[model samples]
Target: MLQAHEADIFRPDVTVLAPQEAVPARRERFATRLSPQDLERRAWKRRVNTIHVNTDVVVKAVARFDQMLADLADDVEGQCLVVPAPSGAGKSHLLARLQMRPSLVPFRDEVGPVRPLVFIKAPSPCTLKTLGLALYVALTDLELSATLKEHDIWRRVRHQMHAQLVSVVMVDEFHHALRGRTGDERRALVETLKNLVIPDPNDPLRPPGAEMRPISLVLSGMPWLRRVLKEDFQLLRRCIFMPIRPLGHSAACVKKATKFLELIEPRLGFPAPSGLSEHDMVQRMLKASAGYTGRMMHLVKKAAFRAIRSGAPSISQLDHLAFVFDEIFELGPHRNPFRVPDISTCPKLKEIEFDKLTRLMGTAQADIDPDDA
Candidate 1:
């Protein structure tokens, strides 16, 4: 089995694990004060064991992904699947599940290991050389010297993908390829990706009449990635676009979002009902989360933990959510949507304030630097 590097760019964002068997144990430890280890274990269990909610958007995106894989089985030349969404819209979570599909699992045979799917994030300052290295790392455990020439690294990546029978290459945060780069650099990046889906015949590695095994590409990033693809007609034509829409204020959207929270509440292990699906609570949640699924889940998780630490039986009241929201965003009573008397009167932000969230969480966002090679 080939192990991916620990760096963010070379590793999958999430790992989907099979459901674990329930362990038989003595009960009645509720009175005991929970230690840090216990708290973390509870959080981990909630994350891994939560039921997967399939909204209309998720069902369609998954169906499209399956179709992409099915086409490969028929020896169809690889096509691109582009999933563009706002930050914290659960795009990475969706990609993670797709990567772990039974059919795409890595396997080995008499020849060697065959990886049906390779997932890697595009590195920040994504030069061709850096992108190649990211692919190489995800494809194999072997360490390659960073001093290798750009073309040389890409040649090796192409050869390895072919040899390993890689059917799909998922590049998460692909918009990194265009950020703060020159027009020429963007063009080069776009062309390189296009060539992956439809191999360039002029390449020295491909003999005039030899069969070229094309690898399908999955490019996922923020909505800006769509504009980038549009700039290059060839790449745009090859792509199947899927967007993960955020939870909105519409009646249907609110109802769906409320139901989603209801599903998650049971998984939090609270003894009492939280009434997360109530119209008032759901509306306040929508504002606090900026209608982003990821942000909403993050808020819920934090509130659950706060309740646990404070010896509350459940995340049962609006105050529980309000306290955590204020703690997370450093907002005053009036500014916190959850605390406000009229949530409708509160000003809405276009997106979740992820920078503040990250600071509160005490984790630096990983942007793989090319120079770190």
Candidate 2:
């Protein structure tokens, strides 16, 4: 289970509106409109809410979806697919983007049925039962009952699903069930995947004469998932592994860094933004992030209040690096003598001025060339 502290601690969920023409008024009820701040203090929520800012990652996410379609197009026999990346790699962000994006086409037009995208996170306190519950919930309002015949439940859901074309069921954090959990939990999880991504759904449970819906279960998690799967009996063989490893950020991401900075401003209770240049913002961010998602998120967050307070239209490269260094998650635990319980509220030394970072940091100009000090 996710601790309360972990919930919305890193990011907030955001809603982006597509062009009005693209959305129908009634269907638009599902729309989430994000304010500027959602990307600031609650950027982690954005992990489940925001659009993918980084294009390369977006393409990869889409590509992964396409791969899922292709694999299941012929045979929906594969075990869940895994998208694994390192801690700072932004796996959740990518997953969230995919979750929020609307269908490229409608669920149906004049056609008989179309596939709908069904995305879900595996319940942390998840089990085979919980997995069934998730699938059940996604399909309809049915109560979770072990006694409910699997095929019977599917028959009902399958009928519902026929109204839509492909239902891509995305399960994030597959590794949680795979590693370090109890054996029963693992087995339960495996069974859940089997029942969910069953090869065919028409004739009932998997045997020679059975038919199944070609549901795609994309499971994502930390990089260790690949290794974790190796130890499992049938899982490693059935699933195709998609490494969610971080690609070095592109010049394009840094090119207009101001967009990200402004995107993060509202999260920190910042006022509306004014004039800002993209070049400087991107440059500063690139330096601070050194190209890691977790750190990048932090950098965006830390700069919010500062950028707002200064009335600067854009966060300067200097400011970006300073915040990134100060707030972003380091590759490992951070250690610095200047660090305090809360840098914002740390008591000023007797000789130092609050506004003068130099005296606050107890360093001379030569010793601290950076603006962060």
- Top lDDT model: 1
Instruction: Assess candidate 2 and give its lDDT.
Output: 0.50
Q: Pick the candidate with the highest TM-score.
A: 1
Candidate 2 lDDT, 1-373, residue by residue in tens: 6688877564457455477854785567876776675444355433323323554555776776666666665775644667775444456566666665555233556865454666666664555555556666765656656677545555555455545554566766655554346766676556545555665344453343334655556677655556445645555666766664332336665443555554544443334442233454344344433344444554454454456445555544445434444443332212211233233333222211111322122212111113322
Off by over 4 Å in 1: 1-51, 205-210, 316-320, 355-373
Minimum summed lDDT over a 10-residue window in model 2 is located at 360-369
TM-score of every model versus the real structure: 0.80, 0.53
After superposing all C-alphas onto the true structure, candidate 2 shows an RMSD in angstroms of: 14.3
lDDT of each: 0.75, 0.50
Residue 218's C-alpha lDDT in candidate 1? 91
Q: Model 1 over residues 1-373: C-alpha lDDT tens digits?
A: 5555546445566554444522222223335678886887567556634546676767887888898888876653678999887666667767876786789989999999999999987887677778889889999977578899877887788788778888899988787776677777778777777777777778664434545767788988767777567767877888998888777899888988888888887877767888888888899888887787767777787787777766666785465788887777776777788878998888775344554664354332333234321
